[model samples]
Target: MSSSVGPGDGSANRDAEFTETLKSVAGMANLTQSRQVIREIGSSVIQCAHDRTVSIIVARQVLDGLAGKLRSSGSDDTAEADAVVDIADYLLREINAQGQSSNLVDQTVGLCEVAATAFETKEEYTEAAQRLASIPLDESRRRVSPEDKVRVWIRIVRDYLEVDDSTAAEPYLNKAKGAIFDVNDAELNLHFKLSQARINDAKREFLAASASYHDISFSPKLAEEERLHTLTMAVRCAVLAPAGPSRARALGRLYKDERSVMLANDFSILEKMFLNRLLQPKEIKEFAETLQPHQLATTADGSTVLERAVIEHNLLGVSLVYNNIPIASLANLLGLSNDEAKTEAVAARMIEQGRLVGRIDQLKGMVWFEGGEASGQNGSGKTAAPVDKELRYWGANVQSLAEEVERVTAELQKQFPGFVEANLVV
Candidate 1:
């Protein structure tokens, strides 16, 4: 392989020169020559990777060049893809063969990061995150600064997020969260915020995610198109949030953001939410098409997240149009499968939980909308004193019923005393 002299290295010309040489050796068809390159890369080449930006760029290019070489060898089929991945694995194997805590410990840490970038380029996010996580950042082994820790943790978080592995990403997210306050880099801070928002969205903390995303959409660092895309994400998260007051505020904010009007498909639903208009099944189905698998994941009661959101939203809509509706009819409005009990249970739970801001009359089989907090279900998770309000209403109703019965009995005694006497103790 022909070598070029000092082609824009990440650090000193010597280190860059050495790395550029490894890139050439990586492309060689001979396996023996390729096998020997890992020692140089895992040691000298990697030890020089202090300039993270340039190091990542050059290292990623080296892996990309190898992948390109493998592809150029023959057919554009699955086997070629496998071969590309194999080359990356081969480098890791050779490095690990030398044992982990060699004199080149720093270089080993850097090499893992470099290898991870290659996996990420292939869209093998799980592997990429695993590669990055292999770095030992425990202060005992390596005393990494808070900023540095945040950098690596955020990278791992971003890769895990790509595969929707929020559970796995969580510990690292906490680690980053604790360390991020010390980080002053604008770009890194933005990345951390964005990652947190993604995790929230995946975990179905949609209202929090909506607020975070909307905040990000206003960042000056993003391009106009990117801002619009972020705004769209904010809308999606808000829509998925359980129907309640917090979600209402989120929706109201987005509705007022003139840019929301630019969202072609999402704008329709946003408009429905703003006006308390009922959403059609087809319209929700269309919006659901754009959701991630987790967004459609089923809840405890066997309904999907989208279905739950729609049911809650529709119930609020029904309350808006009717002062009181029968449980059976409410079930129809919510598109529940003739399960009046299920519908009643759902409505009652939302009301009692301080989500729906209304009440259900089980005996009369009716939903009575007080209509005070229409846009505000207080849903998703905001605490309010619901028990006191409900109990007060219940006490007032009991008193009112007694008064009406007494007044009716008085009229009966004055008009039909014999009939009243036959039925009453008095």
Candidate 2:
């Protein structure tokens, strides 16, 4: 009484379906329609041969025909979209089962790439990443060029980033990093750098993320709007960075950037933070609205990252305006509660960490500001001290320092091999 046919009967019907499909495709007047119909075959009836190898050979020919042939037009055709994904997945399982065939592998790459694009368009990023990851990077089977591999891995990183999966994205990003230099395409390299920035941002390495975003903002290859958008992102990351000499220097670079002026909302906060001006609750609230969910994430201190950054930044701001302030009073000024001990602890930590450039007088319940117009961590009137801020690092995971070191080494290796080899490790 079951409606489902037995396996043998179903196989016969599928085989018949495949035979008729090819005939219908051969007689078709429109090449695009023929291709679209074929696009659905692997998902539906490509298994008609019953032999996995034979089916792959047939499916590969159809996919190869799809190569160099564009879709010609967009469609909301959900059925066609679903079929495209199914085709890729079918190839995926067969590829795993069968040993690598050079011809099949080559065509599989193209079809999988197309399927990945379809997934991305539908905003199914995890599926897109998996589709891209399934591509065979084994050079023994086929030629896998550096740029080609970088393109795929970077695309995977971008997909994982889209879904807020940094852990998943990191390995693919590292894969791309190894091949990025060999890629001559500026756009691809730009995206590689952007992906790194995105991961750092997700990981709360704001200083590092800001530096990359700031550098990218100056790329001449970017359109004006795109450049400005990156500039905006740079400012946000910089503002969210920890209050210290390194962060101060990073903020200075963005503040000095001419393009930063184009983004009024971002520029306003940038100016205030760079000048060490106290931020109001209203202003902070408005600026907070512009940040991404990750940017607004909570820290171990039970405060949003934005809240922590602002409080610490305001502490530095107040330090510049006053020679000394009581701990209770400092708490109120920093928008914290009437908790003098907690306020004093924050000051003490910043001073110990060389961020506040001050001395906390616990007995007197006062923080003696060391920077001026009050005194001068050189936390003073605008412009940071003309020192080599590039070498400064916060701690173990300061990603910016490593990146900056690499840039300098790459430049130095161009002309000074001895210095690079002796002092720097690539």
Q: Best candidate, lDDT-wise? A: 1
Q: Which stretches of candidate 1 lie over 4 Å from their true place?
A: 1-33, 36-102, 139-143, 374-426
* Worst 10 contiguous positions by lDDT, candidate 1: 380-389
Per-candidate TM-score against the hidden true structure: 0.71, 0.74
Deviation of model 2 at 23, angstroms: 7.8
Tens digits of per-residue lDDT, candidate 2, 152-267, equal 99999999999999999999998887788789999999999999999999999999999999889889989989888888998999999988788888989988887788898888
Distance from true position, residue 66, model 2, in Å?
Answer: 5.4
lDDT for model 2, on a 0 to 1 scale? 0.73
RMSD of each: 12.6, 16.2
Residue-by-residue lDDT tens digits, candidate 1, 1-426: 112324454244554665577566655764333443543453443333332323544554444444345434433344443444555555456445544334334544655665576577667899989989988787375678988889999999999999889999988999998889999998899999899999999989999899999999999989999999889999999999988777888899999999998999898998898777999999999999998899999999999999988898888888778888898888987899779978876776677556666666556777677646634434422234333245546868999999999999999999999998899984
RMSD of 2: 16.2
